[model samples]
Target chain A: MSKIIEIKKLRKVYGDGVELVALDDVDLTIEEGEVLSIVGPSGSGKSTLLNMIGLLDTPSNGEIWLKGQNISKASSKERARLRNKELGFIFQYHHLLPEFSAVENVMMPLLIAGVEKKEARHRAITLLEEVGLGDQLNNKPNQLSGGQNQRVAVARALAGHPSIVIGDEPTGNLDSKSSDMIYELLRKLNREMNQTFILVTHDMDMAEKTDRILRLVDGKIVCEMLRDGDKFVTRDLCKLDK
Target chain B: MLELFVAMKHIRTRKRQTVLAVGAVGLAVAIIIVFRSLMNGSFETFFDIFFELAPHVLVLPKEGEEYIYLYKTLIEFIWAIPGVAAVSPALSTTATLSFEDNVENVDMTGVVPAELNKVTSIGDKYMIEGDLYAIQSGRRVALGDKMIEKLEVQMGEDVVASFPDANTMNLVVAGVFRTGVEEWDQAAFVSLETAQEFLGDGDVITYINIQIEDPYQADEVAAEISALGYDAESWRTMFPQFEESLAFETFSNNLILVLVLLIASFGIANVMNMLVLEKTREVGMLMAMGTNQSQIRRIFLIESGILGLAGGIFGTAFGYLVSAYFNSLQYTVNAPTAPQPIVIKFLVDPFDLIAFSLLALILSMIAGVYPAHKASKLDPVVALRG
Candidate 1:
């Protein structure tokens, strides 16, 4: 498969007064239609790498590419536009706007992409159907359960039909049964719709099940593994003992 | 437009706060409108007194430092002017009257009994206790209301009137008259011939009261009379000091208008600032959705503008209602110079409403500028972080 996202010699530092390196000399290439996982302990720089690829944060040096576009040098607005059209992001907290309904939250990415209201609604409904929560579309985040709201957030991240999805512990707030369901859904979409997945998680058995896994420790890639089928947030929710 | 609806929804949701802000604006507008109206109404009402109760033009003695017993030439000259309504000649002098040692100083005016009807109707209304024809017959004289009260005398009571020439003559109380003024109500009206004889002017009159077609033409008539070498004065000229008082009231009213607008501007600014603060995250969300800075600014400007415009319209109506309420208060006042009602009447101009509304909207728009700029400057990444 051809590489769809490339990160070359990327480094991210925090603080102006005292330097803290969140990502250090990281180089990565994610192929088209690939399902990849970056797994590590709590402070192992996996989430920071995910942020750099998602364009939610810029690397201090080096270049990152998304599809055919060089996105490392994109302006803040350009980054927003790219995120709206070419990528989908799901975070552990479900980050659905508390003021909006589940469907409206799902429609957000399409709206951000400048899709017309009706068209955005239609696509949001379709994505919600894909996530198996079509009946819950009108409910707000507060009105819905944990697993339900996370599914809605997942539906939102997929609404614009982006080629790639990046999830940072997307099911961290969910029960084991819900985590299994979410992992199954992501795998199904990855295989059927040819969507690429780059997820950061602490799930060891789940990482061993993915098509590729890069393990990190103390701001460095310590190991890598290649496998198939599924990966879930935190391997403790996995079927490893089964 | 959609954004405005959303903002309005937020405002409506916070009913108490919105009402307080709107009430502030409404109260300011109402007070301003009523003040301007009452000032205008009183000003108009005050001028009407001169036209209705006093002469529009007066032709007086033209000679230097001499009393005018007769200004026949000036009276005839003014009577021929195009807008002249009627002219009556008059002579007046002060004399003391006594009924058994009760002496009252009386102002005696000599006027043609028939022509004087056009100026006032005191002679027609009063009764003569001696005889109906006594005043015209020159056999008896009239007594004032206050004089009767002081002298404790009935009509037909024998009275002695003494003039400046040491002439004390016996007469009967012919009648009593009232002219709605304390001073005029006390004055005695005798036939011009009788008064001329009493003052010893010998058929010459002192001044002429020339009624003009319109009260506004009083100044022009007075100027024409002046050109003819007569010292002509209009009612307005007679009340220069009164007019000066009214002018001061107008200045104070304008000062109050400034104070209200300044305070109302602060209210509008505060509301707009709150709106901008509340919508910060929403604005950031919109910016991340690829909306430009101008679109974000337009949303806020349009939002505050709607608030301002609605406030202005309601405030103007509120002002009108307050003025109308003032108009309803019609108790009469008895001022020493010119009596009036205890209440103020409402009067307004459409121009005043339009000007005040525009001023309010401009203030609201000015208040929106900084907040709008702040919203537009938000960066998407930092905004979307949470």
Candidate 2:
């Protein structure tokens, strides 16, 4: 498969006085239709790396080639356009607009992209149904349960049919059953639609279900594991560095 | 379009705050309307009453000269100028009137009765009894009712009139009238020929009274007349204090208008700021969904602008209703300078109401700018964390 994203030496520094390094010389690549996860302990920079690839934050230094465009230093406006057209994001919390109903929340990305309201609503209905929320179309975020809200958020993320979806602990706040349901739903979308997904999670069980996993520590990827049928092959980048 | 939709929802959901804001603007507009209505009503009533009988411009004898010789030519010259509706050349002199056991001092004016009728409302509006035209007959005069009272004389009676160093004349009082003005009610009117005879002066008049189509144009007409070497004065020049007071009132009105609008705009700003603070996470989510900074700003700006427009409309309607209610009262006040009590009416110009509403809308939009900018400049990462 052709590479959909390529990152070369990404670095993000935080604070003017303390200068904490959030992401340090991180390099990675993902192929089209790949389902991958980044897992680590607290303060491991998994969210920061997701934000960089999601175009929500600028890196201190990096060359990011997304679908053949070098967007590392892209202007904020251009980045925002790319975010709308090429990427989708699911946070740990639902992050659905409290003012909008389920269908309306799902229709937001399409609306932001200037889609016609009628067509956007139609597409949002199909996506919500795909996420098993067909009957909750008119319910607001407060009216839905935690898992249902996150499913609605997933429907919103997939509304624009973006090339890549990024999830920062997409099921972190859910119970085990709800988390498994969400993971299966995301996997089903990835396999059925051939869409790429990159998730950040603390749950090893969820991360192990992905096709590949990158383990991070102290702002660096220290290990990687690749799924092989029912097993996984591990690689230790820390030892390879020496 | 999305910004507008979101803005409408935001305002709709905050019903209490919106009502308070709209009520503030409404009260301000209502206060201004009531104040302006009463103020303009007073000025209008004063103009209607005073200009009813007074000349717009009066041409008196030139300095160092007692009378205008060949006044007929001057009268014709004044009538040809644009806006000059009527002109009456008259001679006025102090005279002593004696009628059997009563004697009184009277100011007597000589005129062509028809011309005097055209210049002032005395003949139609103020006359209480008898016809002014009766003075057209020789040796006949119209005496004020008050003067008639002082002389203990009635119409068809004879009164002896004498001026200092001039011949005494016995005139038949053919008419009696009252004008409600103390000075005019103590006066008498006779034919020009009789006045010339009584003064023993040949073909000369002391002053000319002019009525113009527009009283406000009096100054220009007076200027034109003064250029001909006569002493001319417009009513405005004769009453500088009135203009000064009106100017002061206008200044205070503008000041109050600005202050009231400023106070109302502050309310708008406060509501918008609170909205921005409360919607921080929502703003971040919008940004993450690829809504640009400018679009974020537009949402908040449109929200406040909607509030402003709503407030403006509310205020305009409220102001109109209050002014109309005040007008229905039909109050009256005594005017010490005027002959009778004046009725007060509230008058509002439709155009003024529209302009004030638009001004409120514009100011409210301005008030939205700061908060909208602050919302736009928010860091998406930090905001999303909240």
Kindly list the per-residue Cα lDDT of model 1 for residues B250-312, writing each as its tens digit: 888888896887688677678767766765665655553345566667766775666666677
Residue B236, candidate 1: alpha-carbon lDDT:
73
Error of 2 at B287 (Å): 1.1
* Clash number for candidate 2: 0
Candidate 2: residue pairs that collide = none
Clashes of 1: 8
Q: Please give, for residues B1-386, the per-residue lDDT of candidate 2 as tens digits.
A: 67886788777767888887777776777777777777778778767776766778999988899999979889889988999888988998888989998888888999988778877767766666678898888998898878988888988989999867878989999888776777888899999888988899788999999988888899999999899899999989988777788789888987988798889888989988988998998898888899998998899888877777777777777777887888888777886655456778788878768877877778888889999999998888888998
Instruction: Give candidate 1's fnat, 2 decimals.
Output: 0.20
Give the per-residue Cα lDDT of candidate 1 at B159: 77
Model 2 chain B: lowest-lDDT 10 consecutive positions: B334-343
Instruction: State the lDDT at B95 in candidate 1.
Output: 72
lDDT for residue A147 in candidate 1, whole number 0-100: 90
